[model samples]
Target: MTPHRPSQHARRLVAALLAGSGLALGGCHADRIVNEAYPTTYQQRHPIVLSEGAARLDLPVGGGAGGLTERQRQDIRAFAADWRKNGRGPVGMMIPDAAAGVHSSPAIRNTLAAAGVPSTQIVSRRYPVDGPETAVVKLGYVKLKANVPHPCGLWPEDLGHGGGDYYGASQNREYWNFGCATQANLAAQVADPEDLARPRAQSPVYAARRQTVIEKHRDGEDTTTNYRQEDVEVSEVGGK
Candidate 1:
């Protein structure tokens, strides 16, 4: 018995099916090409990172016979307060040898002590200086800081179309440098770096006010307090 051969119509149908499959595969490949991505959000791309850094203050000393000036004392006090709040380790003092005659380490130490810093927390090291009159005492302490690790203004990928960075150019999204400045500024403006990671604890509710509100609610009265205000007409500056 001769083997039954597929008819022309059946062969054509098989060809059509194979062509459809090829087109589907081509479509999948195209999708893969387009779906390549960099970080979609600026927060992911340029995140604010918390790290240990030195919070430093430079105090310029004038060769005077008197002790620390009022301004200098205030600066030391403020620095001491900041250290008390956020400092991780001892406060370091880079005392210049040139200013030794005018502004001694002992005087600065006393000032720091008066500002509530313990003598043990204040560490001093003498550094050689060329200019005695223009010497500056550098005070610093380790503190937690929030900042963006990646430096801005980098053109790692070409902005214009064409080249190896075709995917970035093709997508109508923000570039690598976009929103970087905003992120950096936000990090700088943050009073406490830790707040970026977690929200602060809620403050205690006012007991008296809460009691008043509860009583008002219980008595079916208005819970909100009303304040007297002067009557005013609506703005008619631009209306007929």
Candidate 2:
């Protein structure tokens, strides 16, 4: 039988690996006479880190007394509810000093207290207001955020076609560290890296639903829900 020849893919992979390892050194950069230039195509990926940071909700000045209107009250209630639900650290109130101590700070505090955020858990601080702009009270607390270390797009070394990374370009494969910034940006965009890493704890079960299911099970009836749906108009089902 004739001697079998290595396939094209095998030949290319070997050439690329050899190019990756220099002919002179046998690892990275060694002197070699091989012309194995393929399109460089590999991308580098970065990891995301989760850290604790302050979360702030800006409350703009309203027309009502204390600088809050009915709409503002509703919004503050929602904010307080969120803080009560997810706060892992004490909440802080940052009042602007330009507005004579937020005319309605007391009432706002009361609303927050009623929404499960107790008085003891709240801290107050005052800062100088900017210009004559309406004062804004910033409600903030500690929350988890996704962060990427170091900014992207740093190319100190030359990526030429004659030596070093040039060899990578000759091979059809991607450069050693290509597309790293894209990966880093994607990691940074994650809203909750901790949530992505692990699932949240399940909330308490619905007592009413559980009881209804139990009763149905005892009576030998189906406990599964069958929601009603509107019938689609037959005329629009198909074109004439």
Candidate 3:
């Protein structure tokens, strides 16, 4: 009994050794994390993706037994131009199941045809109307659209809460929502969504311009073209 009791000094030594081991392990873990390849760039975190989607427009039909009004005609013509530009497959029309639709359907078809859309490519279907609500002719076509899959405005982790320590701002990394709005805006504003993934076909070269430049270069003349500035100067005080 009480023959072998560890002294306080021995206990302290054991505690110190354990603390040093823990620190060493923690250092190794931190190094591993730093070395791992992570998606740190905003572009990588929020990528613009191209996918198939629909471009739609609604044309309100007037109750009066007449063809589309002047404004409606212009709107339909513009919508038809868009379809001709980027539409895929057949251009679809979801008309209300009413007499107005029957009356305007032929006129709409004629307008679309006049705008270069083939009659064969125009498809129409009827949707039942419950009551005397406003009837809208829904025109839709499939097209390539760019978007971000991950929705914005979601904060999974509190930016201020740094997971006790060695996280969040301490790591000096981007948050989840960073560059999301930029990516979304770019996707929305891009004229051609497919351009995000790959380049389009090159346009035809300007033969006349190319020939002029070549002639100038061969004749030992300046190849650059200078245009005349015809606009009047706002201020001529500085020897304009």
lDDT, ranked from best to worst: 1, 3, 2
lDDT to native, each model: 0.84, 0.70, 0.83
Question: Residue 111 in model 1: shift from native, Å?
Answer: 1.8
Candidate 1 lDDT over residue span 1-240, tens digit each: 999999999999999999999999988887766564577788988999999999998877763345467777788899999999999999999988774533556777888898889999988887888886657888999999999999978767777657556666666767788889999999999988999999999999999999999999999999998976678567879886
Residue 4's lDDT within candidate 3 is 92
Q: Candidates 1 and 2: which is better by lDDT?
A: 1
Model 3, 46-102: lDDT tens per residue? 889989999888877754336588777788899888888878889999988777776
Which runs in model 3 stand beyond 4 Å of their true positions?
Answer: 1-38, 63-65, 161-166, 227-240
Question: What's the C-alpha lDDT at position 22 in model 1?
Answer: 100
Backbone clashes per model, in order? 0, 20, 0
For candidate 2, what is the TM-score? 0.55
Best by lDDT: 1
lDDT, residue 45, candidate 2: 35
Tell me the lDDT of candidate 3.
0.83
lDDT measured at residue 129 in model 2 versus the true structure, 0 to 100: 72
- Model 3 residue 145 CA deviation (Å) reads 0.6
Question: Which residue pairs collide in model 1, if any?
Answer: none
List ranges where model 2 is wrong by over 4 Å.
1-44, 130-134, 151-167, 171-191, 199-240
Candidate 3: lDDT of 35?
A: 66
